[model samples]
Target: MDVDVFVAAHRQEWDRLAQLLRRGRRLSGAETDELVSLYQRTATHLSQLQSWAPDPAVVNRLTTLVARARSVVVGTRRATWRDALHYFTAGFPAACYRTRAWWVPTALVFILATAGIGAWIAGSPEVQASIGAPDELREMTRPGGGYESYYSSSPAAAFSFQVWTNNMVVAGISLTLGVFLGIPVLWVLLQNAMNVGTGVGLMAAADRLDVFLGLILPHGLLELTAVFIAAGVGLRLGWTVIDPGRLTRGAALAREGRAALGMVIGLTLILLISGLIEGLVTPSSLPTWARIGIGVAVETAFLAYVLILGRRAVRAGETGDVTAGDREDELPVAA
Candidate 1:
C-alpha cells in the first residue's frame, strides 16, 4: 500500500471533517450527518494507513484531526452551577467520609502528640530554656504580650486574608506532595503540631493556659480538622502508590488524586470559615465559653455534613470522582 496513494484517497474526507469541526455549533442537520460519516471514514482510513502504509506524518495528522472531530461529534459537557452544588453537597463530603480511616487516626495522633509535647515543655524549665531565653519566653506568654498582640497587630480583614492564604498553601502542599509517598505530608503535620505545642507550653509555663485555650480553641478545632483531612488524603494517596489493591498503580493514583483535589477545594472553604473565626472571634472580647461554643457548633456541623451526607452520598455511589461521562474510556487489562 503506497502511503501517497492512501493519503490521496482519504484527504477529501479528512478535509471535510475539519471543515465541519470548524463550523461547530453552526453545522446544519445534513452537514452534521456528513460530519459523522466523514469522521468514521477517516478513522477507518487512519487504521488502514497504520496497518499498511505506516506514514508517521500522515498518522500524526490523522490522530489530531480524529481527536478534534471526536470532541465536536461527542460534545464536551461544560460545568454548570448545578455541578458546583452537587460537588459540595455530595462529592466533597463523600470523599472525606470515605477516608475516615486515615484522617481520624491522624487527628487523634496529632492531638496526643501536641498535648504530650506541651506538657513536657511546660513542666521542665530546661525544656523552656532550650526553646528560648527566659525573658523571650516571658514576653511571648505575658498578658497583652506577643501571643495576644500578634492577632490584633494587623487589621482584622488583612489578617484574615493572610491566614487564609497561608493555610491554603499549606493544604495545597500536603495534597500535591502526597505522590512522594507522604513523607513531606508527615513533615508538614509534624511541624504544625510542634508549633502549636510550643505555643501551648510557653503559655502554660506563664500560668496562662486558660488564656491560650480561649484564644486558640475558637478557631483551632475546625482549622486543625481541615489540615488533618488534607494530610490523611495525602498519606492515602502515597499508600495507593505502594499497594493499589485491585486497580493498577496508575489508575489508583488517578482516582485518589482526583478525590484529593476535590478535598482541597472543599477544605479551602472550611479554612475560610476557620480564618474568619480566628480573625473575628478569637481576638474578640466575647466570653471564652461563648467563643468556644461557636467553634464547637461549627465543628459539629462539619462532622455531621461528613458522617450524614457523606455516608448517604457514598452509599448512593458517589466516589467524589469526576462523572463517568467526563472520563476517557480505558482499555481493558487482564489481571
Candidate 2:
C-alpha cells in the first residue's frame, strides 16, 4: 500500500501501455497482445492504488490510462456467436453450479417449508378455514376445477409468454433484491413457498392431492428450481457484503453482481421453457404421468447440465463471470 513502492513497480507497464495507445492502432499482432496484457496489469494496479492508497494524482492518471486502453482493446472487438455459445455452455451453468452451495440448500428449505405448510393447512381445519370457506376450497381443489382450467384458460403460446413474464419477475426480484442483505429475497421466496403450500393443503384437504400434483408437477419442478437458483444467488450476493473473504466489499460485490446479472439472462430463458410446459403440457390430454414425465426429464437434464458442464467449467477456472477481457482482474495483495 506504500504509494511510492507501488508506483515504482508498475510505472513501466503503465508507460508501455501509454506508448502503445499513442500508436494509433497500427501495432503488430504481438504488440496488440502485449497491449492487452499491460492493460490488464495496469488496470489491476490502478484498482489497487485507488482502493488502498487513494492518491488523487496517481489514481486519476491510471484511471485515464486504463480507460484509454479499454477503448482501444474493446472498441474494435466484437462479440461473436461464439461468445454467446460460451456464455450458455460454460459461463451461465458454471455460475449456477458455483452457487450450488447457496441454491441447493435454498431448494431444500423451500421444499421443506412448502411441505410443512401444506401439512399444517391440510391437517388443521383452522388453517384450512382461514385460507377460504370450505365450499370455495372444495370448488377450487375439485377435479377439473380452477386448477385444471387455469392452464387452458388462454392460448398456449400466449399463456406461455404470460407465465414466463410472471416467473421472470419473481426470479428477477429474487436475484436482484439479494443486495439488501438478502432479506427481501427471503421474503419473496417465503411468499412463493406459502402459496404453493396453500394449494397443497387445500388439495389434500379436498382429497384431491393427486390432481394438484398432476397439474403443477408438469412445469412446477423446473420453474421453481430456477426461482430457487435466483433466490440463492441473491442471498449469496447479500452475504458477500458481510464476509467478502479477502476481496474488498466493492470487489466482491462487483464480481457477484456481474455473475448474478448473467444468471438473470440464463434464468429468463429457463423460465421460458417451463412456461411452455405449463401452457402446453399441463393442459394436454396426455396422461398425467406423461406430462409429469416430460417435466422431470427437463429438470433432470438441467441438473446434469449444471453438475456436469458447470462443474467442468468451474474446475477449468471459470468463475461464471464474463470472459476475462470483459471483466476486471482483482488486485493481488500480499499476505
Candidate 3:
C-alpha cells in the first residue's frame, strides 16, 4: 500500500480515538493498555505500508481496521452530565462577549427609557389625565389586592406558579419578539418598561411606594435582567444581518451562528430560573431592606457578568486559541 494511503487511513483511526476520549468512559487499566497497544500496532503497520503501494486486499484490510477502531470507541463511550454542561458553559463567554457591545447596552437603554417614561407619566397630572386611567395595567399593578390574593388563597403553590407564569410570559415575549430583530425587541421592552414604571409610579403616587418597591424589586430585578439579556442576543443576531463586517454577510452570519447558540441557551436557563424565583419569592413577606439588598445584588451581579466577566472571557478565547495545525488536539482519547 502506498504510504500516503496508509497514513490517511490511520489518521482517520486516530480521529476516532480522539472523539472517544473526549466522550469519556470508565475503563480498566488492562483494557486501556490493550487499546493503546492496538493503536500503536496500527500506527506501525500504516507506517510500513505507506512507502509501498499495497494491493487492493491491503487497502480493504486498513479500512476494516479503521472501522473496528471506531466501533471500539463507540462501544466504550458513556455520556457524562458534567461534559454537557461544560460544553454549554464553555461557549457562554464567547457568545456573550462577542455581541455585548451592541445588545447589552441597547437592552438596558430600552428598559431604562421605557421605565423612566412610564414613571414620569405616572408622576405627571396632565399626562396621567391625558392617558386617563392606567388601563388594564392598573388592575394587575396592585400587590396586596390582586397579587397577594394568589398567595393568600394558596400560600404554598399559587405564588410559585404566579411568579413562574409571569416571568415566563415576559421571557417568552422578549424572545419571540426578537424575531423582529432590534425594533420588535425594542417595542416589547418598551411595553414592559412602561407597564412596570406606570405600575410602580401609580403605587408610589397612592402612597404605597415602600410596599410597591418591596413587592416588585425582589424578583423583578432578576426577571427583567434575564429578558434584557435575551433581547440583547436577538438584537445581535439581527444586527449581524444588517451590518456584516469585512466578511461577506453569509460568511459572517455562519461564523456568528455557532456562537449564537450559546447565548440563546444561556438565556433560556436564565429565564427558567428567573421565572421560578419570581413566582416563589416576589410575592413573599420579605422586608423592604431585604428586597432592596436583593435587587441591588441581582443587578450588580448581572452587570458584572454581562459587561465585565463576559468581556474578559471572550478576549481570552480570541487571544489564547491557536488555529494552526492542531490535528493532534482532536477530541481526547478516553484513558
Candidate 4:
C-alpha cells in the first residue's frame, strides 16, 4: 500500500495514541512496544512521502502523525543502574567530539604550564616564589613521615570526605565558570591543573617520592581524569558563545548549554566516586601493590565502559532494536 494511504487510514489512531501518551495513562506492555514500532515506521513514512504529489487530506494526516510520532513516550521511568551507566557513556563522549571545547582546556593547560616553566627558567624569582607553597601540609603527611597528621586524626573517613569535597568543589567551579564562556572556565581549569602539578612538584622536591606515589596514585588518576572531563564540558559550553555558528550568541549558548548540562551532572558523579576512593581506598591499610591494582582496575573499568562498551550498547540499541512490548503483547496475562 502507498505510505500516504497507510497514514491516512491510521491518522485517527495516531492522534489517539498521542493523547494516551501525553495523558500518562498506563499503557499495557504490548501497547508501549507497538507505539515504539509505529514511531519508527511513521518517521520513515513521512520522510519518503515528502516529495510525492501532496494531497490535502494526506498532508493533514501526515502532520498530525509526525507530531504524535515524536511526542509519545511512556514517561520517565525509574532509571536502573544500567540506564545511568548508559546515559553517562553516551552523554560525555558525544558532547566531547561534537564540540571544539573538548581540546581547548587541555591545550590551554599545556600552554600555561609551558609559560610558567619558561618564566621559572628565566630566573624570575617572582615566578619561583609564586610557585612555592606557603605551607607543606600535604608534604608533612607522608607514610614514613608526619604526613598522616592531616587525616591521622579522623583516619580513613577524614581523608575520604576531604578528597570527595574537594573534587565536588572543583567540578562545580568548572561548570559554573562556563557562564563566562571559555574565558572564566579556562581560568578555573588552569588554576586546578596548576595546583595539581605544583602539589606534585612540591612532593617530589621534598624527596618523598614513595609517599607521593602511595598517597596520590591510587585515586588521583580518577580524580584528575574527572576534573578534565568537567573542564571539557565547560569548554564546550563556552564554545557555543564564542563561536555560536549561525545563531546569535545567546541562542547558540542556550542550545549548547542544554546539551552540555548532562555532561556536568555525569562529571559530578565521577568526582564523587573518585573522592570515595581517594578518601577510603587510597589511605586504606592495604599494601601499596594492592592499592595500585585496585586503582588500575577502577580506571580500566571506567575507560572500557566509556570508550568501548558504551558505544557497543548504543549501536545495539540503534540496529539490534528493543521490542518494548507491542499492543498485542499488552493484552492482559490471564491470571
Off by more than 4 A, model 3: 1-82, 126-143, 147-181, 302-309, 318-335
What's the candidate order when arranged by decreasing lDDT?
A: 2, 1, 4, 3
Question: C-alpha displacement of 137 in model 4, angstroms?
Answer: 8.6
Candidates' C-alpha lDDT: 0.88, 0.89, 0.58, 0.60
How well does candidate 1 match the true structure, expressed as C-alpha RMSD? 5.1
C-alpha lDDT of residue 332 in model 4: 19
TM-score (C-alpha, index-matched) for candidate 4: 0.58
**Pairs that clash in candidate 1:** none
Tens-place lDDT digits, model 1, residues 1-335: 88887778778888878877874359789988998888877777766665556688998898788777778778888889999999999999999999999999999999999998899999999999999988898888998999999878888898988999999988898899988999999999999989999998889889999999988899999999999999999999999999999875766888899889878779999999999999999898899999999999999999999999999999999998888766533434222
- True-structure RMSD, every candidate: 5.1, 3.8, 10.2, 10.3
Model 1 worst lDDT window (10 residues)? 326-335
Best candidate, TM-score: 2
lDDT value, candidate 4, whole model? 0.60
What would the per-residue lDDT of candidate 2 be over residues 1-335, giving only the tens digit for each residue?
68999888888888888999995459999999999999888878877775778899998898889888888888756889998899999999999999999999999999999999999999999988887887887678777787778889999999999999999999888778899999999999899999999989888888889989999998999999999899999999999999999778877898999999988879998999999999999999999899999999999999999999999999999988877777644556554
Between candidates 3 and 4, name the one with more favorable lDDT: 4
Pick the winner on lDDT between candidates 1 and 2.
Answer: 2
Order of the predicted models by TM-score, top scorer first: 2, 1, 3, 4
Q: What is the lDDT of residue 91 in candidate 1?
A: 94
Total backbone collisions for each predicted model = 0, 0, 8, 11
Using TM-score as the measure, name the better of candidate 1 and candidate 2: 2
Tens digit of per-residue lDDT, candidate 4, span 222-252: 7766766667667766766678786546445
